[model samples]
Target: MSSIYLVLDMQNDLVHAGGPNGKSPLGEQVVARDVVNKTARAIAKARDAGVPVAFVRVGFSPDYRECPKGSAVFSGAPAAGIFKLGAWGTEIHPALGKREEDALITKHRVSPFYATDLEVLLRTLGVKRIYCSGVASQAVVQATVRDAHDRDFDVVVLEDCCAGPSAEEHRNSMQSIARFCRTESSEAMRFETLI
Candidate 1:
């Protein structure tokens, strides 16, 4: 099946050790999982296999106009002054070795497909399946996987290339997601087999 790999929310603030959210208790767990290197390797493998890649990030306007005040997940963002557009925190983590040819999508919500051009891009690219890897498996990864599945796209979760605030959360999310999508480590994906 024709496929694209999505590297989701591996932004500096969410993954890097020195970024805004990087020092948070949850960030510590993300950092400990070494998802950056794992995701980087998955990107490399996808590129080598000639699969298109898309980088998805979450960010808001400078005035925080797009941020919702009632959502607990993002309510603090405006006050915290993080994830603003053009800010270093919103940039993709440097460790991923992003390429100019890859597509970039900035989103305001958990699911990459929500209010984003991701669906259009996927359709434009004729993407039949998506390989997902990202930080906070229980959040963005889970949301995106279910949304993608609902959108009628075959979805695969690169489990090793994803992390969460805790091991249990990660494990539980993966277990639940298995009902909707296939879950595998980056090493097990074997791009050649898919082709």
Candidate 2:
């Protein structure tokens, strides 16, 4: 099958209402309350359809050594906290738990394709049609979709499965990305329809 569904950065650090921490400074400030539920449904649909599912997580090395010291995102991250490998925050959210065969890709940057084994894995699988879904749409979704386009993949972004810091940001990002990739609701992009 050429089609693969990539679920990006759906880790507990970013998703889940009562996740690792009672409240995420970032999530609380943005994202819809139903994001986790929405993405989970999409994942379930993909799995049920036998579509290849790839999970992407944003994490740092044990020492945060791999992280750029000056990056705004990591600049003030707690000296010792989640998002570190093996930590609860870095784990894939409970909603989209990983199975033995699911591909788990740990990304250092926003783009899952950047400096990661994603491309090689995709190539090996002969994936050509990519259904993208994830958080922080303006960043990960935008960059990854663009890169996927450049790499000559048929790309579609499932809007219902993606969440941003706010509805405005999510809407804006989806609107912008619609120019390059097919942006549709998760329901409309159901695996039954696509497969």
Candidate 3:
């Protein structure tokens, strides 16, 4: 079975130190976990192991037309002036070293698979197992695990590569998703083994 690394929601608004989330607890955990650097190393390892990498970003148009109204999570995007596509906040953080050949999956809502081409891309890549890592473990990471599991795809989540609103929240979310997927830290997961 082929595997792909699906890195989610590492956009500036969510993980960068200067972004809005930078002032939030999520940012604290992000920095504390050193996710950007660790994920960068992991990406390099994946590339070395010949594992394809895909990045999932949540963004909306300048007018926010693609954004869903009354979404508890995304409702504030328009008013807050964040998550606008083509904006720095929505762009993947520079530390990840995204390449043009890497698959970029853009979504409007919390779930990358929701109304997005993520599943299609997975199928196209002949990917049967997804190695997942992302921000806000309570949201996108868990959603990816659950949805991908439901779609009959094997899922492995890198615990250290993910963060949440708080440390406790991140742990709790990881525990919740453990039911649907395997969880491992970036350091312990060997990309070649998964491939």
Q: Rate the local accuracy (lDDT) of all candidates.
A: 0.87, 0.79, 0.90
> Clash totals for all models, in order?
0, 2, 0
Ranking, lDDT, top scorer first: 3, 1, 2
* Candidate 1 residue spans exceeding 4 A from truth: 192-195
- Model 2 scores a C-alpha lDDT of 0.79
Models 1 onward score TM values of: 0.95, 0.90, 0.96
Mark the regions of model 3 whose C-alpha exceeds 4 Å error after superposition.
193-195
Task: Find the candidate with the highest lDDT and give its number.
Answer: 3
Model 3: per-residue lDDT, tens digit, 19-56?
99997888999999999999998898889889999999
Q: Pick the candidate with the highest TM-score.
A: 3
Model 2, 18-106: lDDT tens digits are 56433654475334446677777888888888788889998887788767678776655556465788888888888676787989999
What is candidate 3's TM-score against the reference?
0.96
